[model samples]
Target chain A: MLERSHIQSTGFRNVGPVGERTGFELRLRQANYRGTRLSLIEGVTITVDGVLYPAAHNLVRIGSRVYTPAELDAATETRLAVGEYMTVIVPRPGGLAPGVHWVESAIGYRHPYFPPAHQSAVARDARHATIVMA
Target chain B: MTGFRYGVSLYSYTDDLGTVMTLDDAFDHVADTGATGLEILGETSVPLYPEPPAAWLDHWFAQLERYQLEPTNFACWVDTRIQLDRKLTVAEGAEQIALDLRLAHRLGFKFIRPKFGVIDYNLTPDPIWEGAVERNLDLAQALGIIILPEIHAPTPIHHPVTEGYIAFIERTGTRNFGLMLDTGIFQDRPLTAWGGGDIEAIRKDAPDMVNGIKVPVEHLDDIIRYVPFIQAKFHHVDEDLHDHQIPWERIVPRLKALGYAGYLSSEYEGVRDPWVAIEQVRRQHALIRRLEAEWEAQHA
Candidate 1:
């Protein structure tokens, strides 16, 4: 079972070689009530310790495959199911000091039913998660 | 007296499902409520939806038999706007309906509620809904399923969207199609906690929905004949068995008076804390059943 909160602590770690980290990645349980196709998901934005990582710089990894924001717009058949989790990769040169940090995630989901301007309704979640490894 | 069929939609336990609850747990709760029907969203409830594994299929029937419950409605969606840039072609939309109808039939469901993509804040469905549904009418009849599009909150019954649906039924004269009324329209109070979506955006987009649409219960008299199922959409129900948002008191009696014997499937959209929905749904069942019994006893 996934954590109750949308932002999960299980997969929170730095990517690339441990000491020379390229960035950090955090797992987020599917934000919508129902499974949504990848294209329907606009992008995922992350903020850690008040430092913002916009959607444009984040690459979403669902299962083993990773997708860019533009790729998500074209990947119509690929769906992110409920109970499933996606990883948001944020590029930070030094990652973070090994400790607990306040983190937040916002998934911009475009519902076809919603009018044009409000299509991307943000499902936002914030929590403090521990990064055991530096 | 014909009584309303009791049921619970798995929607009540949306956030809880993967966190603290499972499909088996949901069945136990619904059965303990003495609900005879079980409703589920096709995409959310079925693993690897559209093509659930064979083993899961077997487990599904097993659960139904063990719980002594019947499948009532399979909720689905038509992403009319399938992508960020383009809309679903008519063929793609029809295939979507056909796929859901077959799956609903296979799962022993009597109704398939297709939530079509809307074009506006009023929830006016995309134009493709008509052509797509029209193409699938024969298949629905053969499968013994009713295709329902919900008259949800932010959209009243007398509006053009609903009138357009009624007009489609009249023009096509199809028994396979009808309206599914969500009780949220009758909600007269403000919601303190909304689990369904981003609350601030909803407040900005549809204030009427946030405050309450308060569709007069009497309007049920006009459309009761076309409505075959109801999503008892509610927010909060306290220990005293009082719903804070939806007006079930007025809604139930009118349904009873209209002789509506369809399913009142609970859709509890409220505070999303774990295990909250489980208790909330129980309170709703208790609240509605008491109201129903009161109505029946008064008439008797």
Candidate 2:
């Protein structure tokens, strides 16, 4: 008999009845602007389950329907017309967490709250000075 | 005996008082907050540099009276880097202490809260420490004011420095020396947030590090017997207010039961909006007033 390890595959979104009567909040971030890094995801059209979620304050939203950009299968159309919005229907199979899990930017890397630890530059300078003195 | 009047320390509103508040504005603000007194910072609030003129002193007292707020204290610090060594020499520390006393006397402050250098500075409480205390008390007594050494963070009540502080006062046998116990020593943050500043950093390296800092709320019973002034410190939360991380529900009652008539200042540190923060101080003030009334109702 071989011992087996149970592996749980959890995805980007978690969809279920909100616990404690409070719905979970999720952020829809635009990571790809065709290699052009810019704030305000300008001229980006977004939708959640065919409902129009306008990009305002660089964020688009559907009431209680949390969706991320990764969840949207991009169409050949690169840009929406001026004052035009995109319409994409919710995938029949996709929902929230337990419904879908989208890949995120490399985790455990470059988290602003976790700054990289470095040796003191002053201490290094002091050591060099001492070496020069010697 | 008139109970020690409530006051606001300028350090309590470092954001507003440091920038927007002038001495006159501070008096007005403290009075508006219903505080009976004010504690002005030496450099920031008092005309310490180039000496405070007699006319300036007179104007300060007039402003204080106009707002009906007494000058309770002047918080004084010594720039030890200029005077160096872990502790200041008795003569050196005394010079600064005497300045605090003179300023207090001039501005009509009955008390002076002096920061006894940084926590690490007085770790072992050496002879220099004793010398500083002796000299400060002497200067304060001569000036007819009480010099209070504040028991703040990085030093617990039971720390040797605190015990040595009490011993120094008792040994000197001067009525002009005392303690200012800041309630922040008893505060508790989430274990994950202890020193990491992350509020989410769980240290697998050291299990006990989570509860690394303790402020001696249990020893508050011992320390309160000697408390002359209290930094009635209120942050956004009270959980981080003490060494044992004392919840005010327990600590406040204990202080009241002890008949602590010391000044309880409104030290609000909620970093939102000025109006909102002031409102917070008011709410806490109301809570304290109710607590004091309840205590009096029973004890009186």
Best by DockQ: 1
lDDT of each: 0.92, 0.49
- Report the C-alpha displacement of residue A132, candidate 2, in angstroms: 43
Q: Write the per-residue lDDT of candidate 1 for residues B1-300, one digit (tens) a residue.
A: 899999999999988888889989999998998999999999898888889899999999999999999999999999888777899988999999999999999999999999888888789898999999999999999999999999998899999999999999999999999999999999999988888887787887778878998999999999999999999999999989999988888999999999999999999999988989888989999999999999999999
Model 1: chain B TM-score relative to the native chain B: 0.98
User: Highest TM-score, which number?
Assistant: 1
DockQ of 2: 0.01
State the lDDT of candidate 1 residue by residue for A1-134, as single tens digits.
Answer: 99989999899998878889889999999978888889999889999999999999999999899999999989987888888899999999978778999999999998887766577788999999988888
Q: Chain A vs. true chain A, TM-score per candidate?
A: 0.97, 0.23
State how far residue A71 of model 2 sits from its true place (Å).
60
